[model samples]
Target: MAVARHVADTVLFEGYVLYPYRASATKNRLRWQFGVLVPPSWTAVAEEHDFQRTELLMEPRRGATLALETRFLHAGRRTVQRALPDGGFETVPELRLDDRVLVPWDEGHEEQVRLTVAVDELAGPGVVVPFTRPAAETTEPVTDKAGRVVGRLVRRREEISGVLRIVTGELDGPYTTRRLSVVVENTSDWTPAEDAGRDAALSRSLVAAHTLLCLDAGRFLSLTDPPEWAGGEVARCRNLHTWPVPAGEPGTEDLVLSSPIILEDHPSIAPESPGALYDATEIDEILALRTAALTDEEKREARGTDDRAAAVIDLADSLPAEVLERLHGAVRGLREVTTSGTPRTPAPAAGMPDLGPAAPWAGAGGADGAPRPDTPWWDPGADASVDPAHDHVLVGGRPVRAGSRVVLRPRLRHTDAQDLFLDGRRALVEAVLHDVDGGVHIAVTVEDDPGADIRREQGRYLYFQPDEVDVADPGEAS
Candidate 1:
């Protein structure tokens, strides 16, 4: 085995063909992730034009091909980002990406961005990929009243190197979404070592690892259900403000926060890096902050009432169809995993490069939607379509499979003007539908809708029914 020569931003093996990390069944080793993260700036682009995110699952084999999903974020999407100082509505657009017509997130919408690699390495190297710290999920896990890691939310954070790779792809509408396969794989010439040295990549990765483990330890010892990363003097909430969207549209969403958070330095608390703060004490605090900020934005939209609670509820009534599209896959229903669109995963050896898809970070129309009449709280909401013990069933008695495309047609108010308007405009619209007591209970949730019905919750329902509208085949995202 020759002395290994390190690559600047990649993994290298002895002479290109590196040996994979052996399985770890006995003890736990440093968790690792092969995925790459786009920077924070990409959110705006992702939300505005609409893009998709494809999560790649590494097989036991060295590599796999993934496709990108298509998406378009309209007014009501709730995807939010708290890390951005000014809490604002964010998005998780699933851009249609394939082998041809491939595009990068920055191509049309360039802004600050970060792409976090995603993988589940529960067992070991093959079973799980470490990187997960910078995940942009809107919600976070919390502790129980007794101060133990409870089972309300399932959040797994894996750490990886700070420096990430960049992989771009194209997404043309219609028929097939292709992938960009790495035709040329690199070879290394270094000998495998029981211990790897601390190179730049290794250094960044270690920093992330230390931060996460410390966060875990801290969260484990949290004293607040709504955790606060730092607590000393009770700071006044008066100055905490929000950042409005670029345009002052009555119902546009906020993509960033313009407020100032006093990062008071505390020698007592050791930070992994400068300004690297993790409020592991509780995830609810962040959620609350996000909600408040979103509320302020909704009020600014003036689409309806001024009450924060009512505003948020009304905002969710007509979520942008683009947001749903991002999470749905065409064939495998795997959230659009195209070769270029999928998250970049680091192959064990140097040269196996993967830059996770950068679609979602393309634009910013982040989701501050127009307000509308909300479904009554009494509504049971959409039924959980997925159960580990059960199999996939057709929604609303409508046959569906991995590749099924279900067009929705909401039940509109019986009116000559409404019929004439729909017929003259001929616009595309869709609402979710699920079977009930025989006929489909088309949910209604529009400003003037009287019979619209649909309930929204996390991880519980998959279908929604928009009332007093129409459903057409998903067309090419404009």
Candidate 2:
């Protein structure tokens, strides 16, 4: 399921992908383009444009031919980059004024420009030759605020098309061995005054779209069911974010797709290889930091000052088998040592209260071994039942009702959107719903969504099992 991959990538990159993963960063606040199918004319009103579609003319046992047709608005702009103190640069539009003009002259005009295309990694080694044709361009004029023409801005106002024909007949197997990405790049750079708008390719963007096409759809792998090497990648992708198509918009079939291919990182050949960062995830200086306080020497030791762990992880294929084994052993030893020394406590299950003995409604067994019949059942709230025998049907170690505050703790194995449920975030209980099996489902409005993005009117909320949340303290929630 390409859709699942989109969803997982949304999760994996959420918060962490953007620099400074804090929620306060406005850049990380919105889901960019996961599961989004933008029409060719995205800048105009949504109703004015029809959904763009790509056709895959595929046949069984034989290779299929696919066409990538990308159409986008190309504006022209003259810009330059200025360096920042943080060692990065920001793009600034180049602005200049003409003093030689004695009379008012209109510089704004429109013209046509040509675009070249480049196709990348479309086929396996020695197979599937791919080519692209130059795009037919057009131009428009840049006008001043007073309606005086300042300069002519060239625009590639039409579709730039490309075709890729897959020859499965030449391959040894029934299908192509690798996934391919079709990148459409606008090679031409157009310059115009600030009032004319930016270049269609560079200003708006040079690379219009990169389409991912899978040959022999039935033989392809599903993003929803990734293999073991890709499991962690898949999980992270799910945790990313996704956007649904507008209600009346054309379906995904009518959109270009570019999804990340979950591939295993290749091993590095040396300790200081370029891909050393790839090893940082599973083993690196971060591992030492995760452990308890350590002196500088200990931290360096934990980081494998020699970079043996990183080399082994990144350059596994290039090293001798025995040498690789030694590096692996060293890493394993460090992991064991660091993890063994770390202190941790078991987290209590959701909805289970730590009720000390002095409570008025303690369980039946009193100080003595005999059962106490007079003990009253704990009353959590209205619209719920708290039977000890059926913990499954209870919420927050007590019953739940409208207006109760609960936390979200969806299980990983149960729901795909479990990642969407912000763990430990308090939500107001909207209702205690029951299913045919008499199972309890608590409807909750996330505290962050005071406007109620998911509300009772839609029969929607972050519904969860009783064990998924604990009761919030009244004073604290208030």
**For model 1, what is the C-alpha lDDT against the true structure?**
0.22
By summed lDDT, which 10 consecutive residues of candidate 1 come out lowest?
A: 209-218
TM-scores, each model vs. reference: 0.15, 0.26
Q: 124-237 in candidate 2: lDDT tens per residue?
A: 431232333344444444344677555443333323322233222122334333332233323232333445421221223312222333322223223443345544432332
Regions more than 4 Å wrong, model 1: 1-478
The regions of model 2 sitting more than 4 angstroms off are 1-60, 70-73, 78-201, 204-208, 212-222, 225-256, 259-478
Candidate 2 to truth, TM: 0.26
**What does candidate 1's lDDT look like per residue over 67-181, in tens digits?**
2111111011122111223533223221111111111111000012122222122222221111222322224322335564322221222222122122323224331221111
Q: Which candidate is the best by TM-score?
A: 2
Q: How accurate is candidate 2 locally (lDDT)?
A: 0.35
Cα lDDT listed for each candidate: 0.22, 0.35
